[model samples]
Each structure stands twice: as structure tokens, then as C-alpha cells.
Target: MHAPPSPLEAERSDGGSGSVRIGVLVPLTRPGWVEAGHHLLAGIELAGREVNDTGGIAGRPLELVVRDTAADPRKAAAAVDELARLGVAALAGEYHSVVARAAAARADALGLPFLCSSAVLDALTEQPTEWVARLSPPQSRGWRVYADFLLGAGHSRIAVAAQPSIYWASGTRVVRDHLAPRGGTVIELDMNALTPAAVCDALVDHRATALLLLVGHPEPAVSIVKAVRRDQRLAEVMMGAPAGQPEFAAWATSLGDDGAGIPFLRYLPERLGPLGARVERALRERLAGAPSFVAFEGYDTITVLADVLRSHGTDRARTAESWPRVAVQGSRGRIEFSRTPGISVWQWTGTPVHVVDRDPAEPGRFRILHAG
Candidate 1:
């Protein structure tokens, strides 16, 4: 088979006239989560189409210049630079947190307004800057809620099967820190040095009631689930994935019944409002499946950016300046930005956080276990 297209070779434009351009960064190839990227792009494209249908940002059609980051921080940073030079009015979209952080830093240095779609790392930038804002709830907020769920479920001794990365490391710290103060204990199972079977052994040795899959999808995550599920000792052990590995259909297709009942964090309201419902139906048709929260985030990124471009014009500085003034109805809820403590960028504090899992009897359907 031919090698996947390079980031530059894969770049393309989607929707609207070329008069006004928005840079779209997504992980559309391997090493990146291609499935998540597709869902994200669908939402962005749908919103862009709708914006054009409604009059196209003050009659100047909003164009999207897309680039594939391939889950690489360096690639994403370079894409930000190239998009900035291309005269894009702003930058948007990135699923991986580390990649988003790199892109955010570059955008800030260059003064390009970036509305990050789905990377939830608490620190998207090393220092505060007005040029970057985020649509997803920070990792600390979501993962802390997840830790609370673990406590409520009576799991005090928890184990995390984690891969080495800044994102995974931060998540581990969040779970550990949040749990330690509340009579909960966390055990770490390093995936770098352990096999699936070894992970099962570690879980049993630690007497961990819950095993959180903090690794990548379909490789160690899938293998660990299988190994643990088959091990009689782990039968009573609960499995969780707060980073949302099982949110996509592939997780079901790969693990099926084995994948069900593993709780994960998602940033969606318990119920969709009128705008959310309308967008859901459209996104469903576009994706040919239920859209993940990431997709809604992508759609909302465009929705907010479109609003800013319309009111603030296409000037980069003007777009960055309008973050605090934003109050648009997104697919999830009323989108607004503010300076949240410990977070470096303009944050939408209202993005809903939910703990959900696939039903054991019906792997295709999700059951909301807890909300935060």
C-alpha cells in the first residue's frame, strides 16, 4: 500500500470563497486519531456550510484551509506558522492536547487568534496570552469529575495503565492528586514496560478495583481490556477510560461487549437544546453515525469564529480581541469565554462534562452514569 500523504501533500480547502480564510488543524492520518479527525472536520464543514447558507460572514464567504497535524507537536506548530503566513484570519481545530499546546504557543507568538476545538490539556500555553482560546473543558475539570465518580462508585484503590506522554502524565497527576485528598489511592501501571498480561498481573497485585486505560486506542488499550476481561481475577475489577477511548464506534467494533460498561468522560450536556438537537441530526447524517462530543466542539468552534468574524471583521487582532465579548449559542450550550483560574487561555466554562459508558447489554447505546 502507498504511504499516507504527508501533511503538506494532504492540505486542502473546504467550504466558502477564498476571500476570508480560517486555518483548520486536525490529525487526519495515523499516529493521529484519524476517526476523531473525520468527525471533527465534519462538524466544522457543516457549520461552515450553514454560515455560507445564511449569508457567508457579511457576504465574504468564510473559507477553511485545512492541514493534517498527524498528532505531531512540531507539525502542528509548523502548520500554525504556515497558516499565519497564508493570511488566515484565524486558526482552529486540533484533537491532540500536546499538538494543540504547540500550535497555541506558536499562534500566541505570531498573534493569530486560535479557537482550539477539542484538546483539553489545562495548560495549552506556557503563559497567558489573548491570542488563544479553548472550547473544551480543561483536563483538570473533567478528570477530577472522573475521580469523583470513582470514589462514589466505591473504588478507592485505582490503577491506571498509562503510556508515556505529557497528556497522559497530566491526566495521571489529576487523578492521583484529586483522589489522594479524598481517601482514594492511585496505582500506576506503566504501559511502556508492561505487556497486556503484565498489566493484568499489576492490577491483581495492587488489589485495584478499577483499571483506567490511559494509553492509546486499539493497541495496548484494546489488548489490556481483553486480557483483563478474560482474567478471572479481574472479573470483579472495573475498567475505565476517562480520556474517552471508547467514545468512537471503532472501540465497539474492536472490543464489542468487552468494551461496554467502561466509564469515560465526555463534554456534552445530559440533554441537547434545540440548537444542539438540530446540529446532532445534521452531524449524524454527515458522519453516518452518532457524533462524538469532539464533533460538536468542532462545529461550535466554527460557530463562535463565524460570530466573531461577522462582528469583528477578518482582522486577526480584532478576532483575538473579541474572545471576552463572545456569547453565541453552540451545539452544546450558550458558548462564552472568561479567564478561569489555573487555565492559560480564554475558556468556555459552561461546556458540560459527563461520565458515560456503553451499556453492557447494548454496546451501541451510551448510558450516562454521572454528570459534572
Candidate 2:
């Protein structure tokens, strides 16, 4: 693969004409969280439209060259290659951590600037690189907060219904490491071998007071929740999904009240500020329903990228260099990027973190249990 064009070459490549195109990587198809993709895309598209409506980047239209990753790392890497070849000024939008990692690696290798929209994995790149930056809080930070929530809720004996994946593994490790020092024990129930009934049985055997769903939605996650809720032996066991699976509507549609009261991590404040409230209204109309934190993350990604592109121009190298200087107001808060310890990308440390769950009395309403 050819290395990305230098600032001068990139400036000339566009011929100082036409739309300012950004390569958008999102999972819009199956095997990829489709609902999450829809919300993400909605936020991105809304922001892109707003940018163009307000004169766009330096009087040129802002266009998004979208590619569906389908939650596959290989597919994401290929998409990065294709987008780079297509001469996109920068890359944006991805919801899955593993897939985003693959894209970030490829973008770094080819010297393309990638403003990751979601994907909270701490090590986005093998080593630090200016080519990549992220909007989501890292798994370590989010899961550590989750562990604290577990401990504060008086559930020291925790069990994780985990699948085999790097993202899940990292989350499990973060929770384990955080809880270990505080006298909390985390039992890993491998989903590969255990059925939903078997998971409940393991909870009973382990005497775990809380069972976290480290698996995917609708299949093992939904099934495990149903099984645990139905099994009288595990009725008192608190259920959780630290990865924010329950933030989407599909979780409620699939499990209803069974899905309610299951706390999960969310990257949103308890109340939306002025900007957040305005974006929330727009996104709700665009989505025809309540928007998840993923949607806000998507909006913020475009918001930040648009700011950079406007101030720094669309040169790939220049865009990457401008990460640390970024200071744009997003729906969530004052968005800024800085080098966070152990994180390889320019991270927005100010992103709000909340532990929330759907109210059992009203499944549509969310209740914030904790904030960090």
C-alpha cells in the first residue's frame, strides 16, 4: 500500500475543488450491531448535513464516503485501504473496538488520520501514533467504574458470562483487576461451553450475587438474561452488561421487563445540557425514537472532525497533527483531545460516564444508578 500523501500533495490531490470527503466506517449489516450502526449513521449524517447547510468546509460541501464494516476486523482493514486509495482527507465512524483497532492500525500504517467515533479499547494502536484518536472512553476507565459500582452496590461476588474476543477479554481483565484489590471476586463463565441454563447453574455454584453479560446481544446475552430471570435459584442475582448493550432499544424489544433493571455503562450525563438537548431532539426525530449515547458519540465525532477540517484544512498529515489542539463543543461536553496514560490515541477524557438501567416500572425510561 502506498503511504498517505503529504500535506502539499494532499492539498493538490483535491485540486482545490469539489466536496471535502471523509471516509466513514460503520457497521450497517448483520453480525455487526445493526441498531448501533443505524444510530451512529443517523448522528453522523445529521451532522454532515448541518455542516453543509452552514457553508461546509471552506465553502466546499462536506461528503461522507461510507463503508459498512459488519463488525469484521478484516473487512475494516480492507475498507481503510480502499478509503485511503480513494483520497479521503480523513477517516471517521466505527462502533466495534476490534474492528476499530484493525482500521486504526491500517490507517496508522498508511498515514491516514482516523477520528474514531466509538470503540473504547485502550490500545487502539499497537504503539502510540498521531494518525488515530478516539472519542469513546477506554474500556479500562469505563469497566473500572463499573467494578466500583458493583462493589458499592454490595455485590462483591461477581460472575461474567464471557465470550472469546479481545474486547470482551480486556473488559473482563479491567473488571477483575479493579475488583481484586477491594475484596471482590470475578468468576468467568465461558460462554463457549456453557448454555444459558448452565450459566445460571454456575452462578448458583459460584454463589455470585451479580452476573455480567460479556456476551453479545439477542443470542447468548438475551438468552442468558431470560434463563437467569426465570431460574428461581438465580432470581436474586443482579444482572449487568458493562458494555452498554442495554442502552439500545432492541434489548428492550427482545427481553422487555426481563431486560429492565440490568445496569450497564453509558457515556452520557444524567441530564443533557443545552447543546445536548438540541442534538437529542434532532437525533430523536432522525431516529424516530430516543437516541443512545452511541448516537451522541457519532455526532461528536463529526463535530470534532468538521472543526479540525475547517481550521486545519483536509490534509491528512495536518489533520492528524491537529488532534492535541482540538477544542470543539460537542453535545456531551467541551470536547478536547490529550495524551492519556496507557492510551495510544488522542483521547477525549471529558466524556461523561454513567451506570444506568431501564426502570422496571417503565422500560422506556432509564434510571441512572451511578456516575463517574
| lDDT values, one for every candidate | 0.91, 0.90
Q: TM-score, each model? A: 0.96, 0.95
Looking at candidate 1, the ten consecutive residues that score lowest on lDDT are 1-10
lDDT of 1 by residue, 121-181 (tens): 9999999999999999999999999999999999999999889999999999999999999
**Clash pairs detected, candidate 2:** none
In candidate 2, residue 291 scores what lDDT? 95
The segments of candidate 2 whose C-alpha lies over 4 angstroms from its true place after superposition are 1-17
Which sections of candidate 1 miss by over 4 Å? Answer: 1-18
For residues 1-372, what per-residue lDDT tens digits would candidate 2 score against the true structure?
A: 222332323433346458788888889888999999989988888888788779889988777778889999999999999989988999999999999999999999999999999899998999999899999999999999999999999999999999999999999999999999999999999999999999988999999999999998889898899899999998789999999999999999999899999999999987889999999999999899999999999999889999999999989999999999999999999999999999999999998999999999999999999998
- Model 1: colliding residue pairs: none
